[model samples]
Target: MARVSQEHLDARRRQILDGAAICFARNGFHATSMQDVLKEVDLSAGAVYRYFSGKEALIAAIVEEVLGQVRDGFEEAALSSPPPPPDLLVSSVLGRVLESKEFLTVDGRPAFPRLVVQVWTETLRNDQLAGILHDGYSAVQKTWGRIVEAYQDTGMMRSDISADRVARTMMAAAMGFLAQQALFGPAPHEILRDGLRALMSVRDPYDTTGGSQLG
Candidate 1:
């Protein structure tokens, strides 16, 4: 018997993952099962099991793939000679989130945010999943923290506050945006960018008079 080529094996693995992603997105992690995945991918038990042992394994893989994009998004920005300002950084990152195909469902809905809500709920009961999520989030936070530190050095951000706190606060805003996106319909990226700019701006965009400034 001939062996399967490496490309074939890789393709099959991705097929299983893609099918699993759809199942989880549509039915959620708890509602989705191995049998559902089997039906979704039209694969036998043995074929699917060869790639993933169980549902959580598939969840971990998919979550890692999703979070990896978030983690890697900060790479080039983190190394800039003069780090991006906080509002620009937030806007740019959220803009990418809005544009990424990974963040959309087959039906073009922003289901990625909804999927993240499910993962957070699952983490309460699944320690391993929590660990996976925590590690990924921490990595992303560190990237933010690095930028915050640079901002402080350049006197762009306050030097009195801790970079970790600033990073965590920014992460909170991003998470809140995701929750809002998931709960509501599609929101324009300008909402994030403009909002951040408004919060940081000394002059109120609405105030036409130069004498009137934002507090």
Candidate 2:
């Protein structure tokens, strides 16, 4: 038997990963069978095994894809603006969620919060999954921390606060709000805006004009 080329393997991997995401998000990580994913991707059982040995492997790949996209979004947002605002970060992150109406109801109820909860809980149970998720999140937080430090350097953030600490605190608040939004029907944007305004109050008032000539 001939070995598949890397490009072919990558393409097949993406197909499998995408199908697995839809399956896991719909049927949950624990409940989604390998057969379900194979059926979703129209792959033969042998082909599925060739790509991912087990359901766990498929789930991990799906999580990696989701988190990888998130990390890329953050990095792009940071580079797009020299010192991105807290509100921009919050909006861009949550906007991804809001854009997926399949995952959000008309009233802002997350359609797949259970799937998210399942993945998060499974991470706690599996060291490998936990490590993967943590690494992705650590990268995200570090990027935000760098942005926070940049803001401080530009005199837009409070001088007394640690950038890392501020990043952690803001991420915590954002995560908590997302969890609440998953459970409740409140708009995340409004909640995030008000919360960011409160957080930024610690520093001197900076107008929205990108720190240009302040009167």
Best by the TM-score measure: 1
> Residue 65 CA error for candidate 2 (Å)?
1.8
What value of lDDT does candidate 1 attain over all alpha carbons? 0.81
Q: What is the C-alpha RMSD of each candidate to the true structure, in Å?
A: 4.5, 5.6
Per residue, candidate 1 scores C-alpha lDDT tens digits across 160-198 of 678899999888888888888878866876787778788
Pairs that collide in candidate 2 are 103-111
Best by lDDT: 1
Angstrom error at residue 27, model 2: 3.5
TM-score of predicted structure 1:
0.84
- lDDT of each structure? 0.81, 0.71
lDDT for each residue of candidate 2 in 87-122, tens digit (9 for 90 to 100): 767766766754553432323344444455567878
